[model samples]
Target chain A: MSQALLFYFFAAVAVLSALGVVFHPRPARALLCLVVTMFALAVHFTLLGAYFVAMAHLIVYAGAVLVLFLFVIMLQGAGAREIALHQRFNIIYLLPAGLVSILLAGGLIALIRGSAFQALKSVDGTAENIGTLLFSQYLLPFEWTSLLILLGVFAAIALAKKDAA
Target chain B: MIPATHYLILSVTLFSIGILGVLIRRNILLILLSIELMLNAANLNLIAGSAMHGRLDGQLSAFFVMVVAAAEVTIGLAIAVLLFRQKNSVDTHEIKELKG
Candidate 1:
């Protein structure tokens, strides 16, 4: 019962906020809504027993990313101006979006039907098990991924610099 | 009343909205935010699966997903800012003036 209630609540919030992200005219309001959405998602992660990841998600996305987005929006001073409507490619865009969604939905449905998707009972996705697997089996990927992130950061700075010049 | 499918469906619904936002919304910043929403939906699925399977793999994957999402948002926002400076608008539509 508790799990069900949490699922519905988070799901509703996620849906609503995602809509807000698209429909909200003001960039600041949209970004703030995204932050609230991220916080709710983090709470959902906690309820699912991924306490560590949940906290990390909150810190990185809501704390860091949202702040950065807000900073950019403020620095740019893009508010009070109307966003241009690029409706020319709407039809073309819908084709890809619909196709992608259908394909993914189909694949997920197939996988669920062919596999066991029953609700797990207290599997305890604790930080310890995550650390163990991440370092042992997924160690290479994890470390390399971090390197990629660093490179990505440098790339962003490079791009920013190029833009500035 | 909520079954595993309930969570799955909800996640998919949110994911679709995020996807819709990315495709239809013309603002680069809003598109990036939508992408974040989509990533969170995937994280939701990961955790929900972990909850159901009694395993830690889902959470582990979710952890990795979170990391990737952070990196992606950083890069994306940087590009968006650059675009903003060049075009004077974050709207993706007015960017037709890009020179090869």
Candidate 2:
């Protein structure tokens, strides 16, 4: 019962903050809202017994990725005048988007409800187990991810560097 | 124990909101954030499945998803920065070179 309650609370937080990320007018505030959403998701991960994943999510998402977003926003300075001029909400666009999202959620929920899930057992999501699995069964993909990260670093540097005239 | 159906429902809700954000927001940063939101929803589904099945495969997959998400954000933000440098604006509608 308590697990259900905890799940509901965090689930509500995740959904609401996610909405904030969408509807908040200011970009910085929207990013903060996304951070809250990430925190709630980390909690959900913990509740689901994926402890290592929960920690990694916090570090990778809230720690690194969001800071990158903040740096970019700070560097550009999303000015108020620009926001007021271009960020006005349009009901025509919103209406269709809302309809589509509602349709998608309804369809997915209906499908989920139709299926029967077996009883759940809490998995061991310890760091040691994940490390072993990463090194053994998933070693190739794991190494490939390191290469992907290197590529991403080079790409970011290349794209953001100013060209000399 | 919470039912898997509930987790699935929550994931669906989050994913839908992400889609809505992507479609309605004109700002490029918000669009990228929405994509992150969608990715998180998928990660939630994977973790829940991992727990339900009493295995670590789903968690490993979620880890990979996170790595990919990180790389995606890096590339995406770099593109956003470049766009701002060229156009002095991060609004999506400003870029229409491919509208033909």
Q: Compare the candidates by lDDT and give the number of the best one.
A: 2
Question: What TM-score would each prediction reach against the true structure?
Answer: 0.86, 0.93
Regions of candidate 2 where Cα sits further than 4 Å from its true position: A79-82, A90-92
| Native contact share for candidate 1 | 0.72
Residue A102 of model 1: what lDDT?
90
How much of the true contact map at the interface does candidate 2 reproduce, as a fraction? 0.80
* Model 2 alpha-carbon miss at residue B86, Å: 0.9
**lDDT of the structure predicted as candidate 1:** 0.78
Residue A74 deviation, candidate 2, in Å?
A: 1.6
Please provide, for model 1 over B1-100, each residue's C-alpha lDDT reduced to its tens digit, 9 standing for 90 to 100: 3456666876787788788878977777778888888888888888888888778888888888878877887788888888887778776668886656
lDDT values of the candidates? 0.78, 0.88
DockQ of the two-chain complex in candidate 1: 0.61
**Highest TM-score: which candidate?**
2
Q: DockQ for each candidate?
A: 0.61, 0.76
Candidate 1 docking quality: incorrect, acceptable, medium or high: medium
Cα shift from native, residue B73, model 2 (Å): 0.8
Question: After aligning candidate 2 to the native by TM-score, how far in Å is the CA of B61 from where it should be?
Answer: 0.7
